[model samples]
Target: MEHADEVYDVIVVGAGIEGSSTAYNLAKFGKRTLLLEQFPLPHSRGSSHGQSRITRKAYGSRDFYTQMMAEAFAMTDELQKECGEQLFINCGCLVIGPRTADFLSKTKSCLKRYGIPHDQFDIYEQRKRFPALSFRDDFEFVLDKSGGLLRSDKILQAFQRQFVRYGGVLCDGEPMIDLYPGTIVSVKTTKGLHRARSVVLTLGPWAAKFLPRLGLNVPLQPLKITVCYWKEKHGGNFNIENFPTFTMNGAAGKHHIYGLPACEYPGLVKICLHHGPNIDPDNRDGVENDWVLDAMKLIIATHFPSLEKEPSIVETCIYTNTPDEDFVLDVHPTWKNIVIGAGFSGHGFKLAPVVGKVLGELATGQKPSYDLSHFKINRFFKTKL
Candidate 1:
């Protein structure tokens, strides 16, 4: 009856937010879960290492996702209580773009559709309210008070801790080398070959490494994103009291740029483009391109005039983006017990808790809490062989 040496109810690969959440939920549901990580714990090699991530309910017209935020926020609350730590801060977020632009218009529409309380401020009002931001008259603002920053690393660690609290096994620093999918999955890692009843691949940038061998090809673009910290001209101009998380649209050289208050890196505030140069996650060597840094500095100088021209600190992270900028969540076509979650692009952090819940549901053959239509594995049908 043994398919391999030993059996587990579920095995999850990748210890990022998605993998940890899936393992946490599976263990909470009484499944013997094994969470695997290629890198050592607390490594900054992946996308989930940052201190702050913006969380909001604003979407263009996607009411379903707008509604999902309620549950996502609730889950964050549950995580905070379970971990006995504060993970979210309601610092408010400002969405600045043209009134006719997709980002701005959709945000207002979604806010109205859900009757979510938001403030509509004019150009003058925005400039008056937030002196740190100096926008042209053409730009408008949609302020959502409910949105704020999530202590991202804390959230991931909380999930990992919670998963362990629920009797889940965590195997870090062991990269998953191979997968033989069937009713039971045989995973080959640097440590050894392990077997489990079901396997969930949330490998992020490394997803294609194992998936293509199984005859499934997805159009996932791996890019290197720059995380930069700019020094304050007045030393505390970008402090939390003066600055909240701001999302700027229609910025030159990039569509969106987000910045957190100067709480993470001392006198430096985190700001960078939402996009980055295409990169291979395996060989993310050398420093970032000067153009990317220049673009961000230009925006900071033009908009956030109070920040020092030079970036105080800089780091890099990899994002495995899908073409449509949506997520891919489904069981492998050839192996039903093998679940996959990828194509998170740049915005996967906020939905990590809920995504983990859905991945757990998929692995257990239970219906997911949210709609799975927009996030199907077959979206890349033409690309898949």
Candidate 2:
């Protein structure tokens, strides 16, 4: 069906956290913006539908992200004030690992370099502080005071609402099927064609499907990750009040194992392995994987004796990873007006606000507020396309 072509100053595809954040920024800047989503609002098919996500400043030596987090946190605070809703909870976070692990020492050094308040807890101190957590004798813990949990689902909703309130147009259930890039980009979606002066592609796992059409091929792997929630055998042991968000790095051969304090599910805490099997995003639900579940059970039985060895509930989420696990935010080499944001890996949610702002600035031909050279797509251009 051909509908009337309505031109917009900017059109953002993939209305997840990144897309919504971009649209919100564009609209707030007084641009005639349009936001499009492939699925219905509040759907569980994508990565942003989760109830909670850990937000922290410690990035295991990634100081660039630590610098960007300052702005991201401030932006989130502004959004909370504007929406008049509680969007974040500062519950602190602990990174646990063996004393010899470089990640632990590097993270502690990074925190110290940034002057972020943190505490180092040896096995004895750890036991005294967080009795619910159990670890090996040689394990060391670093507490990040700035870390906490973000209400991810609510943040999406708040961004969309504030975007519309700022006069941005939102078109749900309209997936961009084709793009004709030129002086003015023509976006063809499932419902209709829309013309825009500039376009921002925050297409998440779907980036690999569309970027080829633009004559750019970046290595992006979409993995289906299992999110597990375990039941606490003793009530109040791992609840939100006392327990802090936690991560165990260099576990099970350098794979990250992380968890959040009990909040979403009563008497249940969220925990999962960070790495998963690569799979097609369309067939994410049917992918077979049991090793992660088995690993989580073993981890819980070994460390979290208070929690059940078996997960009470298991859900799925997708992660689009780059080789370096850093974000890809840059302008299209051929089409300067087109901005691309991809390969956030699994840690991009905490940086979405700054990412969106940078993407919007790129689309509008403005100087970005922060240094984005690290995130440029050129880093991956040397790879065989």
The prediction achieving the highest TM-score against the true structure is 2
Each candidate's clash count? 0, 0
Alpha-carbon shift of residue 133 in model 1 (angstroms): 1.7
Error of 2 at 79 (Å): 0.3
Global lDDT of each candidate: 0.85, 0.90
List where candidate 1 sits over 4 angstroms from the true fold: 1-5, 286-288, 383-385
Best by lDDT: 2
What stretches of model 2 exceed 4 Å from their correct place? 1-5, 252-254, 383-385
Worst 10 residues of 2 by lDDT: 1-10
All candidates: TM-score: 0.96, 0.97
lDDT tens digits by residue: candidate 2, 150-213: 9999999999999999999999988888999988898998898889999999999999778988
Residue range 1-385, candidate 1, lDDT tens digits: 7554368989999999889889998998899889999999988887788788998878677676776788789999999999899999888787888766788888888888778778988888876777767777888888788888999999999999999999999999999888887777889999998888889999998885667887778878888888899888777667777667878888865468888888788889898888888777787755457778889988988888888888889888888899898889888887889999998898888888888999999998898888898888787786552
Tell how far residue 241 is off in model 1, in angstroms: 3.1
